[model samples]
Target chain A: MNTTLTERILGGDVRSAGRLMRWVDDDLPEARHELAALYPHTGRAYLVGVTGNPGSGKSTLVNALVAHLRASGKTVGVVAVDPTSPFSGGAILGDRVRMQQHSLDRGVFIRSVATRGNLGGISRSTPAMVQVLDAMGFDVVIIETVGVGQDEVDIVRLADTNIVVTVPGLGDDVQAEKAGLMEIADIFVINKSDQTGADRLLRELRTMLHLRPRDAATEWTPPVLKTIAVRDEGIDTLLTNIEAHTSWLSAHGARHQRDRTRAQQFVRLIVTEALSHRLNHALASSDWQSTLDALLARTQNPHDAADALLNAILEPR
Target chain B: MSQEPKPRTYRVLIGKPGLDGHDRGAKVIARALRDAGFEVIYSGLHQTPEMLVRIALQEDVDCIGLSILSGAHNTLMPEIVRLLEAEGAGDIFVFGGGIIPENDIGPLKEAGVRAIFTPGTPTTEVIEYLREACANRYQ
Candidate 1:
């Protein structure tokens, strides 16, 4: 059954793809069977991350970029991740509202994901979701994230090219120089460029780049581009730079390096989750409950209890 | 009922179809559903029945709410349910809202619309209905 569904998804059945993604979001045990089937067919699509602070026009920019990509005959998949409501665990993925122009396009597929209380705003399922789109034959996959604190940096792990968007007159220049945003930005976009402080924001971004140290051997000159995404201005230039960056990745073999780093992080993430799950299972025993009681009673030190738990877990059962 | 409750992430797609451009109601319902703990995707104005169904399939929404005010509910609303059935997605719950007349409600429900929300219905009603309708869907 899973293989048939996987085949259908690979054959461009959007329904099958959607069902699989829902399974992933719900963390169903059966999702792994289909994901394993889809794994080998992934890795062909270009992954781009669009991130910026709230109200920075990331959605509009991504919508324009999707239009541009479609005009050039590319099939695009978009994952717009929004913060989850802590109370209800629900999310209003308004990014899909901004990009609704492409909603009916057969060549485009857009999925909105909730952060689901995941720290850093980007969901842990995003990379796997992108792989699903890639396996489904999207030429490009764009992950647009709510760029709250740490989100801009977290997206770097998933994207082949990361574009950090900001608006003018928002005091974003000082915010950009705060280290995290400036470091992960492969392309800096001053969206709403027709606004008052466009030029100043552009200059500030340039100055920050100049002040930052670079590796002379493989220095990527991250271009600062301006765009009024509502009017579709500067979209062509943005696409051109994206193409150049992809080409640069291939030319310098940095794509492989990036993939290797992504693989390492992926493995580490899975290992950490697995270890936590196993530890929790081990700690559920009556012996561990006694240990906890001892710690609470101040009969055993925390370090000694921790060593005992580790020894218990490591011992052959 | 005494067991611990698992986290719920029910996805609902709210669509506005046909030429009637009033999306305020749709947006309001979408937000309400979001606040009620359902992931809501609002398909903006002027979506076709085909487009709505496609969005539902691609989005894997558990339910679809179509809002139309062009008095085309007789034609458009049933067409969405038909498409869902034809696409082997009949299990996907279909509902409607708009300036739908009282006379048309029975036919819409017969055509597989589980419920309809007219202009003055409270948002909580829809949320409450969906919670029960979609509860038993998952094993």
Candidate 2:
């Protein structure tokens, strides 16, 4: 009668899924084994990523989106990320507060994660937690990143549909005219459209889209939509657009390519993290102290010392 | 780069249960805990015991810090503890802070609340207690 955590997760135990997510966050070595077991059961849940600047209503929009998805009889899982303090490594993951309506819903599972010094607006363990939720049979998994600026495009690699949320009067229209978060969006949401300057922001976004070079016959131009997430306005339209994007991806076979790209990135990240762990261990060894001493004494050049250290770890005696 | 594995970052849930709309105490505590380097999940006002327990389980938090100012602490705090225990998550530490009377603290603790920080208790005490309690819980 004894079942492993992986087995329980596969059997749809939500508690086991939460425990596995905690393990992944803490970087427990056993988490890797569980994830390996759960990998094959993934790829079934559609991943949706919502990102925007702070105070842009990203969480509120996600709350509205989840409510809409649930009304249509779909199970949902959310990974909400908030930034950790660089000084203290702490975070206030208040995203769930906006989503308390689904707190007791069996079909909805929401987990909050801290960036924990990882850049790119999400925690290092976010993808693994997504995998856990996917394996637990949630029909859709939504990732809400920390209030991101420009360079946090990592969500594009993981999410099947990336919705970049923007609010009017934040000067985002001007800031987004550049090529970072603006370029990565599969759909653009001008949230809080009830506010002033909404029309101007929409016009600017449309103009920017118009200027971008694309084959109208072949390319999927990301739609610019408007929403007042707090009042649940325009959410149904947003969901329809999301479903449309999904259909587009499938119709064009782009979903398969995206999956391949995600797999490649995931494998590379695992290898990089493993090697970095080993390198950290190696750097604390006596060999590194002597290498540092030689460098300090000017007896060895910086490049040669780097090569020696790499060789020492790569080809250990 | 440290030789030892990274210390597990403790996730604490600050919840307000029952009809009490006042969450200043909870927000203060949540911010204090965040500044002290703990990931704090804030459960907004008027959460039921069922909702709090469900959030705690889903969040996999190390502790649930309940802030109930309504005279309903007697009814609410123990209910949260009972709900958490019923879900087989009694290991998740339960603590409370609010306008609870002195007489109710013992009964609440007896009902499985680990600690109760009445009004006027410094935030540092709670922070220090959590750090020690969470660190010792695993060992």
Candidate 3:
């Protein structure tokens, strides 16, 4: 049964891939088992992350980018991450609405993930979802984040090509320079280019990019492209720049370094998960309960109690 | 004894099938479910039965709440159930809401829809039913 499902998933069974993603979302042990079996087939798909302020039309740009990629006959997988509702723990996942044109096309697979209270715009299971799609043989995987935030920069850790999308009339150059996005953007796009302040935003971004010190080994400078995504304008040039960036990463042997960082993050996430689970288990013990009680009664300080608990759990186990 | 496994959050796909275009009910339920702590995937308007099932399968949702007001519930709801069964995903609990009339509710239930909620049903009542249904649903 396992082999059949794995084989089906590897052969591009969307249902199987989705089932596996469900496992990942629930943090089921089966997901780890399945990923272990499918790990060898991953590491092929190009991951592109698109993130920007909420009204910047990142989803529309992604929809346009998907259309352009499909025109080139490449299979695409999209993971649109939306904020989880703190009140109800639900998400609207409205990004799919803008990309509805690709719904009927089997060449594209789109899934929306709630951030599940993860600070970053991406979901905790995003990297696993990307790996699942990659093993499923998608030529490209696009991760659209939950708009822009300081924490949203986490996408740069996972995506080989990260596009920081901005629009005119939102803010001046200082506003752009203030966010964590400037450091991570491999390509900058000024979407909604026909708007009133687009030229000023473009000129300011170029000036900012020029003023920033260049990395000695960084050959590809982040290019700011203009696009009216709703009308499907400038999508081709955007794709071209993305391709150029991908080629640069490969030729400069930086793809391996990026992959290494991604793997490192994956390992750290797993370790964190494991440690957290163990900590929760240990906290439930009678000894820890008494420790908490003592602290509550002012017999023990929180720092000492915490240190003792850490020592007890971390001691040569 | 080892501790019992944590209750995994329920993931639901609140889909609007057919050409209804009226998604207010679907959006309301999606919000209520989310607020009640269920993870929801709001599949927007104009989805076909096939597309709904495809999404259900892909999202691996525990249940699907179909909202149809285009007077095509009798056809679309059953078709979704049929497709889920055909794909060996019959274990996915299927229920629906929208302008479904009282007379058609019986037939929809017989067609494998687990439950039906018509207009004016309290959001709390729906949440309670889902809590129970998903609690006992096959994993």
lDDT of 3 at A271: 87
State the DockQ, from 0 to 1, for candidate 1.
0.57
lDDT of 2 by residue, B1-139 (tens): 1222334898899999889799999999999999999999998888999999999888888889999888998888888888877888887889999998899999999998999999999999999999998886676
- CAPRI quality level assigned to candidate 3 from its DockQ score: medium
Please give the range of 10 consecutive residues that has the lowest summed lDDT in model 3 chain A: A88-97
Candidate 1 segments whose C-alpha is farther than 4 A from its true place: A1-3, A149-151, A282-285, A311-317, B1-8
What clash pairs does model 2 have? Answer: none
Highest TM-score: which candidate? 2
For model 3, residues A134-192, the per-residue Cα lDDT tens digits are: 99899999999998545477898999999999889986788888877788899999999
| lDDT at A82, model 1 | 91
- TM-score to native of every candidate shown: 0.93, 0.96, 0.92
Chain A of candidate 2 gets a TM-score of: 0.96
| Model 1 docking grade | medium
lDDT of 2 by residue, A1-317 (tens): 39998999898777778788988999988788999999999999999999988899999999999999999999999999999988888888899889989998999999999999899988999999999999999999999999976787889999999999988887755688763877888999999898999999999998888888988766789999999999999999999999999999999999999999999989998888877877888899998899899889999889998887777667744
List candidate 3 stretches off by more than 4 Å.
Answer: A2-4, A215-217, A289-308, B1-7
Work out how many backbone clashes candidate 2 has.
0
